[model samples]
Target: MDYANKTGGSAQKKKSFAGNKAALIFFLLTVPTLLLYIVFFLLPLGMGAYYSMTDWDGFSLSYRFVGFKNYIDILQDNRFLHSVRFTFLYATIVVVLKLFIALVLAIFLSGKLKLRGFFRSVYFFPAVLSMITVGLIFNQIFYSVFPSIGQALGIDWLSRNILGNKSTAIYGIALTNIWHGIATPMVIFIAGLASVPKDLKEASLIDGATPLQRFFSVTIPFLIPMLTVNLVMAIKGTLTVFDYIVAMTDGGPAFATESMGFLIYKHGMAEMKFGYGTAEAIYVFVMIAIISFIQIKILNRKEAGQL
Candidate 1:
């Protein structure tokens, strides 16, 4: 009996030692990432939060703490408010267009079509291009190619520079963004569609289900996760749009296309209203966090329901 207890205790000790070693390995593997996150992300975020309460210009050696004045001023700023509104409108347009177009393209491309490989490569080619490069190319296209074609077609609207018009500039920018953004989401949708069970689709078809009915019933359930991922990406990308605006419009045509991201850059870096810009940046961070959280929650619930 004593021998058995001793043996059992020895086995337990060995098991405990193995578990400790695994935990140590995990800690060692994760520590570097944790340290980097703290240093790069958390540290900067904490400093930005602290600076938002102050009146520090970018080059200042010293500054005074104003305590939420920047936040209050931003809240009342009409230009900032307009930028926020414009960003929302742009996001809505871009997100809808991207998801719809990507879904259609994905569905078509996933089928057995001749030259499918070539078409997929062509569709995905835009995603590999630099956003700035794409923006510049589109800028020239809008300025030169579009107007020439428009004039040839006798279309007055197309003949004019769309980016130069206050009302139409947002659409031009949205078009550029959509052109670049659709590739990634389309690939994602294709992957999701690929994962859909062949048997289920065949069964649905055998049941005399129409293409639209099969899509709504079987295909859509499988694509829900992809939809959620694309939605989140689209929202975040569009909400913080800056590069395209800089390349295409520079928030031009009477600041009609000014986005929150560009506004923050202009104020914080260019204008040297460091404290104010930091406040605006913090506000944007909070807004994004809340929206993302709510979106994830809603989508997760829907995903669970589908399951």
Candidate 2:
């Protein structure tokens, strides 16, 4: 009947209107975040690109366009190359150690342990603290008190300034970084572990699987997705880490502890070679992107058992 058609058409129109209204609300809600992202992230990237083509010092009024001269100089710079090498080494060591420690802690805390909440909070509390503060505190631990304690135990551990020594300075920085960054991954892994199927664990145990076997077979397989997320984060963290390095080492005892990030700061802001710094920044971005892509691909293939 025409009356039925009219009602149906009215209902369809209402649904369409609702959909449009929802879309409008969604757009409005996201507009603030989009604007903030553009202002903070995109705008800086654009300016960095422009600056990389010039010889602009930080306080300069004008700068001459140097094309890719700055980039070429960086490629040929021995110090820069050395810094890049050390950055890779630093990143690799920290990622491996931090994840291994975090995984162990997460697995332990995921079980029916006493004071689980307290332990989780204790572990995660460091992540919430300022990196500068953590660096300073850990410096004391490494320098004065730790050495004193070691001497008491006849360890002779602090024969030299760990933070100021050329040989161990990079490792020292990585240790501080691992301490600060481990909590984030631990919390993530805990969430992942908590979500693992209880039935799956029970079934595996029923089949006479030992604790280690059940973990390796059931728990770890389920953790692949979470591991992907953590690995991505750790790699990015490795490349972009700066504040703790600044507060603790300042690329100390020469350039032994110099990371790409600190070197960028030294050039762009501290040393006032803005153009060169921006070029370095872009290079770092490219490196991080490539590294992250390779890691994600490898992780995905491993999860798919294609490795």
Candidate 3:
């Protein structure tokens, strides 16, 4: 009894010491990150919120509190409203097309194939290019390459340059975004696919399950968590797209391609409507938060049900 008690006491003491060490290590790792978040993100966010309520141009020493005037003005601003609509349409198209292509590619590449690594690298290569570079390159393709190809093929519509037409300009931008953004979700889905249990796959095959059945029954359930993550990220990232729009359309051809980010840049930087732009920026944040929250909540519910 004495030996057992002594051993139990020593074990408890060691466990307590180990717990203390883990807590200390966690604090050390996280404190710097917390400090950085406060200094960089929280501070700027607070300042921007404060400025949004004022009549301060970005470069002014003296300004008065506007008392929700900026927010009210933005609601009446037609250009801002149009940009909001355009952004929603653009984000939806881009996310849907990108995710579809990524899923297809992930499924294909995860299969046994020749030069699989090479194919993956080829598909993923465009993602490494800067958004500005992608936009500029595609701009050239639309303006010069397509026109040349159209002329060669005697196609008048293709010769006319899609970006110049307000009707097709957003689609052109969406295509560009899809081309560049597919790799991210593809990689994510590949990782999820790798995590699927091989034994389950084998059992499905042994039971004479068709490929589609196995994919739907076995693979999809395992991919739910990753799908949730990718969905939220894709929505947030696509909504706030900046450099691609700047280089490709510059919200041009009568503001047809103007996104929320482009509108904020135009107002805050170009027109120097700082307070109003800050108000719009806050709206953008709120929109992202609401949409992301709803998507995550829905997806998590689905995932829980699947499990």
Please give the lDDT score at residue 204 for candidate 1.
98
Each candidate: RMSD: 4.1, 4.5, 4.6
Model 1 lDDT per residue over 169-258, tens place? 999999999999999999999999999999999999999999999999999989999999999999999999999999999988898999
Indicate which candidate wins on TM-score. Answer: 1
Which prediction has more favorable TM-score, 2 or 3? 3
> Better model by TM-score, 1 or 2?
1
Q: Which candidate is the best by lDDT?
A: 1
- How big is the positional error of residue 57 in model 2, measured in Å on the Cα after superposition? 1.6
Our model 1 lands, by Cα RMSD against the true structure, at 4.1
Query: Against the true structure, what is each candidate's TM-score?
Result: 0.90, 0.85, 0.87
All candidates in order of lDDT, best leading: 1, 3, 2
**Position 285, candidate 3: lDDT:** 91
lDDT per model vs. reference: 0.93, 0.85, 0.88
**In candidate 2, how many clashes are counted?**
0
- The better-scoring model by lDDT among 1 and 2 is 1
Which order, best to worst by TM-score? 1, 3, 2
Please list all clashing residue pairs in model 1, or write none if there are none. none
Minimal lDDT window, size 10, model 2: 1-10
